[model samples]
Every structure is written in structure tokens, then in C-alpha cells.
Target: MHNAQPWRFRYHRGSRVFEIRADLERAMPHADPDARGLHIGCGAALLNLRVAAVHEGLHPETLLLPDPADRALVASVGLTGAAAADSGLGALYPAIRQRHSSRFPFDDREIPQPLREALGEAARAEGAALTFPSSWHLDEVLELARESEARNMTDPGGDTDLARWTRLDAASADTTDDGVPYDAFGPRKRGGKSPMRDLAGLREVAGRDAADFERNPQLALLSTPRDHPEDWLRAGQAVERVLLLATLEGLSSSLATQPVEWTDLRWALRDPVSGTGHVQLILRLGYGPEGPGTPRRPASDVLEVLP
Candidate 1:
């Protein structure tokens, strides 16, 4: 959940299949005890793989959780013969590298209606629903986020998880291939009620400036019909699709997952009237500075070649 990048990949050349698996060692036991966040992260990677495949004119036939007995096997993607890929997916390929989780302040400007609808469609394409919360819901969600943050400040386990996954110094940020780096932490929040998580927490980061975030951050909730491993995987893909589309539309985005991490807060995040779906993520999006790109492990480290 904290950019742990908890995933591994195995490619079978003979079968032309790519197997996405969970790297349990990187799982956050405290923040993501049930591994739902881990599945979503793996699912996001799967979506990127699909986008890259489609861009190269290869058809990716994906099967989620193909082996019921192997819970770690998140998905299997079979690469078929060259074919006309979905243009929509291919169009998002450029954004794969462009999209970053912006933790900085977003201007108060509202997103256009057409672009918002397109983002919603992107989530639907990956089997999820995206809704901009009503004013009241937004307040509730924000309050839950603050509560989660406060709890994290006091919880030893949460603090440990945060410290383990965040790079506070410039040297580690430059050398480490995983975790949230100092630069990507963005400026410290001086004022405003934006729900952006302060990855640095109580720790101070040198050279980090303070800024006032938007009073009413443009927030969207991504949800699924059910809460299951399958649903989490779908939610991950849906989130990435929405992000890539938003990137293409000149919007900066970041995830606010604090509220969803807690059981009680998660239930309260649901829309009171509909109460039909399970919320998977809280997304903050608006126009401002794009977050710095975080380090990623080399492909050779995460990908394995198999005969």
C-alpha cells in the first residue's frame, strides 16, 4: 500500500504466458493485513502489462487467479498472435510512464464533466465503479482519513510499516528501487483539508517546502460489487486505467488509502443511500505539479525466465 511493490513475475516462453504472483515478503502485515492492497498493486501491474502488450500489437488473454490452490498466483496473461489491439488501451500506453501519484497540492479548479465521465468509463472497463463523492460523503471520508492518520501516529505497527517503506534521505531515495522517496513525498501540508497522506508522517524531510492544498480536493471513490480477492484485483486494474486516462487528460493524481485500511472506517466510506458496493480506493485528482517518479526495481529482479 505504501509503494511496497509487492509482486513478482514469471514468464513461460514455451506457453507464451506471464504469471503474476504476490511477493508476500513485501506485504504490509499492519497496513494491509488481509492482502487486499497487495492484490490491488499486483492488479495495477497486470493492467500495465496489458497496456504494454496492446501497444505492441499483441493480444493479452488474461485469467485472474487461475489456480485456486495457489493463492499467490494473482493472474496469468497469455500472449496470443499479433492482432489489432484495442485502440483505447493502446492510447493509454504513453501514460504508463507519464502517470505519477501527485502528493502535492492541487489547484481548486474543477475537472471538466466530459473528462470526468471518461475517467468513470475507464474504471467501468476494468469491472469497477468510480463516483465523485457528494459533499457530505467527502467530509466523512476526509474525517476518516484524518482519524486513520491519527491512529497511525499512535500505532507502533503502523509506524513501523511506514518507516520501513519510506525513504527519508536523499541517498536512499537515489539508491533504493522501491518505497516512496523523499522527493515524491511532495510539500508538507501547511493548510487546507485535502486528504493526501503524509508518507513522511512526523518525520521531517530536508528541502521539503510547505504549501496549502485545495480546500475541496477533487476526490473519486473506486468500488466493486463484492469484497474478494478477485474484486480487489479488478479494483486495482480499474484504478490504474482511471489514472492512465487522467494522466492523458492533463490531470495529476494520488491515492488516499488510509480510510480504506481500517475496517470500521471502510464500512463508513460506503454511500449511505446505495450501500451496494465495496469501496476499494480514494483518489485525489486535480491540476498542479506532477509527483516525481519513484524508483522501480529492475525488470530482471522481479521477472523470471522459465522454459
Candidate 2:
């Protein structure tokens, strides 16, 4: 319900499996025409389903990118006979509804070591890597953010889409209720773009205190071995998995796809020293302020029951 929640599941009572599909109509043409973002978003929903299944006292087995004929159909999750319940997973389910993307400044305090380790464990359970950038690595990421801003500003098509989605006029009821609204946008840095708030390009509309911008926030990167629809979906699942864990641990988080969206800059984000694969998202994780919830379409709008 936070942002894009495009998923249609078919639960087969005979096999005890849940089939997951992508709803393309919910996709963003200009920003994510290829459906990377949509797959990722749907992937997150799939993760929620798995967590819910586990909470019901079942072990879940996932098949990624299961059918080539049905490209939109991402995966099928089957329940194993193991009836053991994971208290760790049970702890996170409560936070799912409470978790929203907070774009505002964090408390500017250091993240504790134990919490960072826990976040990593959460992502690992979903087959992805969540790594924090070192000082030099963080600088590399910021440079890419600058590049992302410049690219968006120069590309009229990209700029137009952003403008249409970012709602700065909090009073404007005419805006689309699906994406980031104006008020939820945080402040802009001295010369940087407004962190690509869900809206296209209204930095001024997305409110923020110039004095509260984060200077040295803890940045985490979510990466997958390959950059495919399945991988994007896996990354998305990992994104929520880690975010939910952070929330339960009393932490706040925000996501930045700016660096990963740019092809050349994205390559630069991979550390030669660490030998990791491509980066899917650049996340800001730490003790900080949480932003308000964005709007979403109803469950009936996105879910379809098929025979």
C-alpha cells in the first residue's frame, strides 16, 4: 500500500502453491517502461505473501522467473510440509503496515552494529546482498547521484513524467493519488536535485528544511547477481525484507534508485575491491525522521481472481 502494489496471486489448494503475476497497466511508462520498477514492486508484494504464509506455520519454496511464455507471471511459491514457525518472521509482519518510505532527514546518529548485522541477515534470507558503502564508496555514490540529477534535468521526457507525478501543491486535490505527493518530499541540498522525490521535478513543492539535509547519512546498497526481471523482483523482495527488519528494530529508511538508474554510473557503483555484482538500489538507513505514507489503489483495483 505504500507505493506500487501490483500483484495477482492464484493459490492452488491441491498443490498448496501461490502463483505471482505482474500487472503491467500499473507500470510507469516514462520512468519504468521496461517494468524493472514494476517487477521490483511486485516482487516486494510476493515477499509479503511469503512472510504471511510463513506466519501461518508453513515453509515457503519460491520458483523465480518460472515461466518464459508468461513473462508477466514472475514466480510460483509452494508451501513445504514443515510446520515450524519463525518467531523472527512473526516479529516483522506487524511492521509491514507501519512501514512507509521516509524521505526526511535522519537523526544524524550512527547506526548500531547489531542493527546493521540484522538488516544484512534479513536480505540474505531473500537471496540478495545489502551492503553499506565505505567513505570512499559513499563519495562515489554521491557523484552518481549528481549525474542522475543532470541526466533527468536534460531529458525532457523524463522531466515531464517526474513533473506529473511529484505533487508539491499539498492543496492540489486534482493530482494523481498513486505516486509521491508534494508534502512528503524532503528539502533540496545546495546544488543537488530534490533526491528524485516520487514526483518528477518539483523540488520546491516537496518541502524540506535547508538546515536538515543529511550530510553523512548511512547508505546501503541492495545488489543482485544479474539484472533481469527476476533479479529486480528479488531485489525488491530484499528491499522490503530489510526495510521491515529495520522498522522493527526502531530504524527509519529511504530508497534512492538514482545511482542505479544511470547505466555508466551504475557500473561505477560496483566495487572492484569487493567483487560484488550490479547495484539495484541505494538506500539511506539510520536513526532519523520518518515520512508520511503515500497513496495506493485499493486491493480490488489490482487483484483479480481467475479460474
Candidate 3:
């Protein structure tokens, strides 16, 4: 929900390499000046590509931020070699298509411990950490998020990126194929109590209904060792890993970058007991209505083949 997808790709036919690049032109200057969200989104795409490659009997090896000179170059995924793909990763292929951000209210259902552990392992596999905070800690995190949202919504020029990417206009929604559609808005909050951000951005959703979200929002913080470009990339990959696994396990997830998008709020989001890692993303997982699929620009629009 960080405005919209601000990334592009280049697939070299000759080298059989697929590359991920952060499109600064589409970046949210106000929301993510450091472009951390940009890298995270690209990293998520890289994960999906790897899973798809494994399902198709190919191996995808990644090189994060390969060229330091070109900072926009997020990663290069080499879809080469006939090495046997990891079956476990292939198992998540279906979830790639099934997973979408769910902002709707979720039932008061507790996620099993084993599933939580498994999700933690998934993040660890990508060199990141996902920790579901305790009850009192959750209240703090949600308050931090609320404060951040209040700031973002009120700050001048804060809505710039959101306005650019939200395809709410009737003509825009029908013609162009990118940005969050109105259907994916997940209804207005209507004073509902949840950590989910209202991505609608002041746009009116006709016939939409608002309800009370889960009071005990199942929230988790995805963090990395340090706050660098590479670390951001790792956190992004871990996000996709955990999200795909959650989808497979019948859990719907939403992201609250409101807290993580800001500096002070993000620092407060870290677990007090263990204050080592840099929090990158705030994930909300629960059982709820699946968000409608938003439009995506075709691969041809973003991908280019090298001679």
C-alpha cells in the first residue's frame, strides 16, 4: 500500500537473465524518499520469479544490487542452469497468484504456534526476522501506526504519490492497467479498530461498507540486521516468503507501512525486549475476505530484451 508498484524489469534473452530495477520515476518521493519501499517491492517480485522458475523446472540465482554505480538496479536473477529446483519453493507457486493485500476486518482467530514458527523460518531463510508481538506490545505498535497515519494524512504534499498511483478515476481505471483499483480499497474504515491503513486516500467508494476490524490484530514486524539497500532487499524477499506461506495456510495478510514508512515510528516498532534489528515492514495476518486483484502492467511494458 506504499502508493503503488515503483519497479521495472529487464530480461536478457541472450544471457537468459531477468533483472529487477527500481523505477525512480514512479517512486513515492514523499512516502519513501530513501526508496526502501521501492527496493522491497522489487525484491518481492524477484521472489515470485524464483518460485515460478522452480515450478517450470529451472533454477533462478539472484545477485542483489549487483552494480553499485547503478543504484536503481535492485537485483539480477539468472534464470540459467538445469539444476533441480527446490520443491519446497515450488510448492508456493500457487500462492503467488492467490496472495493479495487484505484490509478487511478479520475474525478473532488466533494463528497456530506451529504456523507462526514456520513463518519465522520462512523469513529466516531469506535472512530476515518476523516476530509477532505480545498483546501489550501490539497496542504500542498500533498506536505508533495511528500517529504515523495522522502525520502522513495531514502533512503537506503527503498525498502526492498516492494520488499519482491510485486508479480511482473512471476513465483511468478502465484504460490504464496499473495502480490500486477501487475494488481493492477493502471498504472504508468507518471507525473500525484495526491497524490496516485506508489506501483509499479520500476517494469515495460508492456502496462500500465499513465494519469493526479485529481488536487483537495479529501483527508481525519484518526486520533486517541493518538499514541498507541490500538489507531492504532481503526484507522484501522475506516478506514474499512469509506471505506466500501464509496464503497457502489459509491466512490472508495486509501490510501497514504507515508505521514502518516513517523514521521515529519505525524505530518504536521494534520489539523492546530485542532491539537489534531494523524493522522494514509491518505485516497483519488473519482470516478475512481476500482483497480483489488489482491491475498490473504487462511484462512487455516493463521488460526489455538485450541484443
Candidate 4:
């Protein structure tokens, strides 16, 4: 996950089909040994592609893991005429560019009920459920995040993925077309109760300031009925859907996967009473400064055309 951007596209012009594949070379072996994160990232990209296609008045019929034998082949979308295009998804096209993972402190502003319901519906549309943790569950989730962050800081192997994908210097931030840049890391957590992962753990940046994050952060847990590659893909789509809707609703958002990264903590993240769904992501949403846009590889670099 560390902004590795582990995905690629192969478009067949004649067929008007887009093949989404996992870029295994960019996979985080240490952080995501099972390649689950890779699939989720690919799934998010797939959702974006669908949104773009719909916005351009095209209908996309998506098939996940179409080739079972080819594990890296995450998804394939067959594009057709606009007769069956989804206008709802097309409306989210503008939010695609506006949405960014906000890492800065969010003020203690509560999201309204109707907007929350709309966001939840967005997730459900993609075959996933988004639940705002109860007060008790929120505490537990925050503790798990703290525990995971501590382990990552002390464990020699934990920092391996973060270091590889984080640009601590201005020069690298300017040159690299991927990875989280120092400017996007936001201010250091001087004091707060928000369960934010310190991406810059033990690494200092020249002018990074410190600020107090919100004492009570508005968090939502994204989950599916089961845990599998297909489910991960659905969760990814659901997550992006929620994010885009939130962005359009004037909310800033960030993702916290630190707790979800640890196996035991991940299990504990599930709801205690129902205890059914498998949590795929921990989302933080509120009003705050939107994170600076990180560099993205050019489409030409990630996409391929075949005659």
C-alpha cells in the first residue's frame, strides 16, 4: 500500500477492452506478503477506470479475475456504447481528481447523518458495507493502530516497505513519479488522539511542522462479507466510491491500514456483536486541509496499446 501503485493496464483497441493487471515488481513483499494489498490497489484503479469510461459516455462491463490461471490479471472491462452507462458513477468523475488522502489534522467537525448514509450507500453499491465504529469499537481500533505503529517502529522488518516508498527529501519528491512525498505526509503528530500512522517514523524532514490532530476523528470501517481476492477487489471499489462521494460532499479523507496490516489486530477490528464482515480498510474523514497531490506515473508509462 505505501503508495507503491502496483498496477498496470493493457488496452486492446480493436476489442475496446482494458485489462487490469497487478505489477508484481511493485508489490510489498514484507508488508503485504499475500498480495492482498496489491489486488485492492488494482481494484481501486479499476474503479477509477470505470468512472472515467462512464464519464466519457461509455458502458463498462467488468469481470474480476477473469483468467483464474493468470493471478496477476486482476480485472477486465469490456467497453460498449453509452446506452447502459451509469450516470451516478459519471457524476463522481469530477471528484476523482479532487480527492486526495488528507494526512493533516482534521478539526472536530461531525459529519451529518444524511451524508453518512449516502456514503454508506455508495459502499453498498459496490458490494461492501461501511460502518462508523461505535465509541467502544473506535477506542479498540485506535489502540490497535497505536500498537501496530509501535511494532513497525521497533521491528526491523516493518520499516522496509515504508522506507522504499517514502520520499524524505525534496529532490526525490520532485523527481519520483510515485511514492508518498514529504509534503504529503502532513504535520507531525504533536498531540492528538487520531489514529494516524506516522509514515515518517523515526525519519526527520527539514521543515515538517507539528500539530494536534482531532481528539475524536470521524472513522469508518469498510468491510465485505468474506475475505478473498474477489472481496478485496469489491472493497477497493467500495472504498474509492465512498471517498469520491465524500470528496464531493466537502470532506477530506485519509486511509489507515496500519491495524489492518497486522493479522491479529485485523481480526479484532471486526464488529464485536455481529462479527461477520472482514474489515478491509480504516477510513478517516473530516474537514481539513486537503493533502498535496503526490506524483503519479504518466498514463503512457502504465498503459499499453496493442494493434
Best candidate, TM-score-wise? 4
Candidate 3 residue-wise lDDT, 239-286, digit = tens: 999999999999998888888878888888776886788999989998
The pairs that clash in candidate 3 are none
Query: lDDT of each model, Cα atoms only?
Result: 0.90, 0.73, 0.83, 0.89
Tens-digit per-residue lDDT, 1-307, candidate 2: 2255567777777777888888766666776767787888888888887778777777778898888999888988889866455536656788878888887767668898888888988888877988887777777777787788777767777766665555666665245557567566655444322243334353454335543456676888888888888789888889989988888888888888766666778888886587768788888877867777777666676555444
lDDT of 3 at 163: 75
When 2 and 4 are scored with lDDT, the better candidate is 4
Query: Which should have the higher TM-score, number 2 or number 4?
Result: 4
Q: Name the Cα RMSD for model 3.
A: 1.7
Spell out the clash pairs found in candidate 4. Answer: none
Runs in model 4 lying further than 4 Å from the true structure = 83-87
TM accuracy, model 1: 0.97
- Write down the TM-score of every candidate: 0.97, 0.87, 0.94, 0.98
Q: What are the per-model numbers of colliding residue pairs?
A: 0, 6, 0, 0
What CA root-mean-square deviation does each model show from the true structure?
1.2, 3.0, 1.7, 1.1
Weakest 10 consecutive residues of candidate 1 by summed lDDT: 81-90
List, residue by residue over 194-226, the lDDT tens digit for candidate 4: 887888888788898999999998999999999
Off by over 4 Å in 2: 12-16, 79-83, 170-177, 190-211
Off by over 4 Å in 1: 84-87
Q: What is the per-residue lDDT of model 1 for residues 97-125, given as tens digits with 9 covering 90 to 100? A: 89878888888999999999999999999
> Which of the two candidates, 2 or 3, achieves a greater TM-score against the reference?
3
Which is the leading candidate under lDDT? 1
